[model samples]
Target: MGIDDRAPGRPRSREADAAILDAALELLIERGAVATSIEQVARRAGVTRATVYRRFPDKAQLLIATIEAAYGDPPPTQEIRDVEHLLTGWASILASPRLRRLLRRLYGAIEDFPEIARAYQRMLGQQRDQARRNVFERARDRGQFPPDTDSDVLLDLLTGAGWQHLAIQPDNCTVEDTERFLRAVLHQAGYRPDGYRQQLVPQGQQPARPGDKE
Candidate 1:
């Protein structure tokens, strides 16, 4: 939307909405939470402060919405048919430059906007956790993991691998290396990748190791 767009409380235009969210996200990543404000967003968006506040009601809500807009929704886990699907999808997200920086911005802004950061992280984390849980359940039912597998424990290991690469060790490992590490870690965590035989382990027992082929 150009300057002199429709006033707030009027029939809002998608153009204006897009512009406002885009500008807010840019400022959030560039200057971080404390530096980003409705006034600044309005100025950068070429919309009025009333437009922003009327759209968002508060700074926290505005910033959160901006983040959601940038990243969109987490991929659904129910669609994942196997461990390969799960790991590859996660690899894509973990290796994303956009997501890497977004996590950085969220933590960086946490000190300034504790409530907002917490709220956003909770929203994002819940969706991610749910997705992971679905994949784990699927893999378990298909015998991709041992029958006795603790899904949540396995998830923690996988999640930590992604978190370490994205937030803590972005420089220490390249994207390809990070993805490879995740696959390796998933194997160690008892995920038998697709195409491997699903040798269903008995309940309350560890998975079987590979046996030599005849």
Candidate 2:
């Protein structure tokens, strides 16, 4: 798409949609949620403001759409084939500098751009949480966690651990390290898959016992 070649009428092709979404994502990562506007995205996308608005309607929706596109497939909900699958997916995402920066921007927007937060919760949070809950329940069924274990609490714990790594320790984050950390948290929380030591613990390293220092 040329600088002046705006698609007329409604967006009719995947090219236009991809261009718009890609431009929006780039601007969001570069300028953040507050500074990025439909006009800027339209210009960057080589489409008109009307073209962008016809797809997104508003900035909140546009930003959320960009984020969801970045998340890719299988999404958090569909990626939960098992505990390992879930943790690995999260570790990969958290280890990404781009995604980490994007998340930080969104975190900042919670107070400044409340609409974005609301849109994110509605569009992504609920389904992701439910998928995680299902994973926890499956773990319980397999005796990784006790029958009485509370999936909600486990979910909160794991989610908090991930955010702490993403937000509080981005400079030191790595996929291997994040995976190990999440596995340690799960081990400490009474999660023990079959052959837990073989699968999770590194060679000759003692698994974290309950009540041990975090």
Candidate 3:
């Protein structure tokens, strides 16, 4: 039978599901994963505990669903105009206190819950791959990067190691550091600075010779 036929009493409401996820996110941000209880979410959402349990089996499932809702779906199409745009997006995500706290909790919880952690990791991998493909496609369309560039390698260099370090590091690293690293890597990979001229060279003129005075 169809979903509606199976539950003839009343179909599950999407609105209530969204409210539960919203409540879960707020509680998670305020009290963290360990302290946030299912009852607290139900109370916050003004729904019964039965409704919450009906949507999510347990706290872990709820947490996972909440995270997915917060991020929304991965972009259907990949596109990266430049390093600046990429860095800007990265900075925005990292700078958000709510997102940071949620990520930190996810990282810690992964150790205790391997299955959930693996699921998250799989989701992340898909996002990274999609992002990598988008970057190459955009760059090629703009003629800014060589068509032959290996997008996968570029993504690994830009995100793989550095992301792990940022996520696991004890001391917090500023977004500036990440931006600087990205710029250097892009320059090394043949990206030219668009707005700024190289220092030690005069604008609209070539560098002065050692024997010739300026």
Highest-scoring model, TM-score? 2
lDDT of 1 by residue, 53-140 (tens): 7788988888888876776743432456656767776676666776677767776776867988677657565666776787787787
Candidate 3 global lDDT: 0.66
- TM agreement with the true structure for every prediction: 0.77, 0.81, 0.58
Per-residue lDDT of 183 in model 3: 64
Better structure of 1 and 2 per TM-score? 2
lDDT of each: 0.73, 0.81, 0.66
Arranged by lDDT with the best first, the candidates are 2, 1, 3
lDDT tens per residue, model 3, 39-121: 99988887888788888888877887898788774453435566568766665556455677777666666675565666655
User: Backbone clashes in each candidate structure, one number apiece?
Assistant: 0, 0, 1
Backbone clashes (count) for model 2: 0
Report lDDT (Cα) of residue 131, candidate 2: 89
**Model 1 residue 33 CA deviation in Å:** 2.1
Cα RMSD of predicted structure 1: 4.0
